[model samples]
Target: MFCSDDPVQLQLPVLETGFPYGELEELLSFLQSDNPTVSPNNSGSEGSNRTLSSPDDRKRRRMMSNRESARRSRWRKKKHLEDTTNELNQLGAENQELKSQLDYVASRFFAVQAENERLRSECASLSARLSDLHWILLAMQNHINPR
Candidate 1:
């Protein structure tokens, strides 16, 4: 078994044929000092300086990483749902505002159309009165000239 403290002198017969010794030493050193920021438990327990050695330790670490990733993914999904809901609400309000504007414009258009019709009818009445007055003036001029 390779000692964690003296990883420099540790050599594996399996890797001795092809792998470089210096790289193996570096790999062992890195694996032994895994999670250096995590302090040792204060429970006066044996193996306080336990490092990741067996395949089980690596599997456990991978499981923990997967769990954390799953948690973040759920959080992201919830946030996206909330964002989509807010956007939907905003669009609905904008749609309502546009509808209101369209209604007001439509009402104004109808009012102008009615006013134009009233003005056109009044113009026709005035033109008929002018034509009658012109006919009366011509009749008076013909009687005075006796022609």
Candidate 2:
């Protein structure tokens, strides 16, 4: 097992097909090997007691790990998108409901305003009729008394 006490780790170049180190023969063998144990979904780490394997083996393991990480990242992104979309849909529905309530309130306000105006008009008409009757009563009283 190679244990590094250094804080800064060395960066390795990611390779897709060809070997970064000039080991064409090892690369060919690694490519031909159908190892189902190197599945991307395999979560277990190579044991803590793992001795330094060949470069091809390390590269293959790294590639598998990278693929698994990418798969998980894509899954998280998809889930986040779904949750956001659902929230947006819910907010849209709530906004529409609020707009409907506002419209109903506005209509009721207009109806009340119209009723108030009608009542004011009726009050003014009644006031004018009462004033006319008071004057007629005064005139009749003055005529009958000759004052």
Candidate 3:
């Protein structure tokens, strides 16, 4: 009986010696067969009686159920973590975009304010020049007509 963990060491000698093929085929089929005793679709009340017939069978069924439940729980947790990471990345990009827009709006607001100040200064200078012209015109009219 071969007890080594390496299958190549067992298979190489077995094949070279022309051993009985039927036993090898049976052993291979049994080793490869990993079908679960209870199918997930029929694990409810409908199949409970079969697993409950013997204490050993009940224990095995419970163990398999626990393993399946743990596998699903781990998968759900991994999916949730991935979803949270994606959402964080999306929100970060949106925040950066909003900051960029705010900066542009602020720059435009400052430029408009400076332009308004310049226009106000020019309007005051033009009003003062107009008032002086009006006074000069009045003096000219008085000199010409003596009124």
Candidate 4:
């Protein structure tokens, strides 16, 4: 097994009939070959005595990593959806409350307008009665003084 700090060095290049492709194929063949130092029985041994990791092992690890990442992505999306639903419900309730307030205010406004109209009619009637009384009082005064 070769260990390197660079990711490019760690990855196996695609197999094409190019300058680096032949070299990569040779390297892959060598890595796929059995280890001469480790026997077949020792290959199954635990811990430090384990054989070098094969391509299959790397593929499995990569698959598991991708699966876990996908699960986490789904969880985040579900949480976001729930939070959005809750916010929408809260907004709807607030809107309903505001509408109720508007209705109450409108009803009060109409009541006040009706009272204002009634007061205006009453004022007009009172002014007419006052004018009639003033005319009657002037006539009585003329009859008493003859001037």
Candidate 5:
């Protein structure tokens, strides 16, 4: 068949010739295959019944289990590290935001205090001026009437 200009068909894996049932079937069958036998070399019913295990078999099992456990633990640790990094970044951003808010509030509070001080000083000065004016009026009235 002449090649069509479809992009979907072009991205497929290039298959090499001369394999049993092609690579796809082999891959599918392998993925669908059951777990391996516990004892691969041992064959007969007597072999099945025997309790004897070779040192090599035990070593292989131990190594496989250890590697699997280590691999899983490593991936888990990687996930945890990534999570921690994300949390720390979020906390840092929040902390910075809170700090900015605090600074803004502090600056506003100082401005208010300064305004209050200025208002208090102005009120005190006005009160002093009013008292002086009252004293001057009383002196003028006493001088004018002799009582």
Candidate 6:
């Protein structure tokens, strides 16, 4: 009833505990005392009206606090999601780099295998040619020493 003329314009503080403990004592005193003051130059009717409006004021405070807490939780959730996204991106990049390194190692292994096979073939050919030369030398010695 204090702001009956401007009900839609009422603004409640968002925090429930933001009002000091001492202020609550003063408010209680005003409610219990024989004379209650509503506003400057206001009459008895407004003071009586405030008694009925007190419950509504308490409800408004509760609602405002709930809204503020909900807003903060949403912001925190968004930040967590953003952090997870960054981590996933970094892991994907690292995975790609590791894949490339594996490919490079595989290519090097194949090159070494090819080189080993070529060297083995060359050794086999050289060994065969050396055996043929030894046989010819033995045959010449026998012809020279026929006596």
Reference-based TM-score, model 6:
0.53
The C-alpha stretches of model 5 lying farther than 4 A from their native spots are: 1-53
Assess the local accuracy of residue 131 in candidate 1 as a C-alpha lDDT between 0 and 100: 97
lDDT of 6 by residue, 47-83 (tens): 6677777777667667755865686688779889999
Best model per lDDT? 6
What TM-score, computed on C-alpha atoms, does each candidate reach? 0.60, 0.57, 0.58, 0.57, 0.62, 0.53
| Worst 10 contiguous positions by lDDT, candidate 4 | 1-10
Clash list (residue pairs), candidate 1: none
lDDT for each candidate structure: 0.70, 0.69, 0.70, 0.69, 0.68, 0.71
How much lDDT does candidate 1 score? 0.70
Model 6 regions more than 4 Å off: 1-58, 138-147
In model 2, residue pairs whose N, Cα or C atoms come closer than 3 Å (at least 3 residues apart or on different chains), thus clashing, are none
Candidate 3 lDDT by residue in tens digits, 71-107: 7688889999999999999999999999999999999
Where does model 3 exceed 4 Å of error?
1-53
Candidate 1 C-alpha error for residue 35, in Å: 6.6
Residue-wise C-alpha lDDT for candidate 4, range 1-147, written one tens digit per residue: 333332233355464422355655564555444233443344355425333455666675578557656876888899999999999999999999999999999999999999999999999999999999999999999999995
TM-score of 2: 0.57
Q: Over the stretch 1-147, how does candidate 1's per-residue lDDT look in tens digits?
A: 332433343354653333366755655666556533333433334344343244666886688557656876888899999999999999999999999999999999999999999999999999999999999999999989985
Clashes of 4: 0
Query: Cα deviation in Å at residue 141, candidate 5?
Result: 3.0
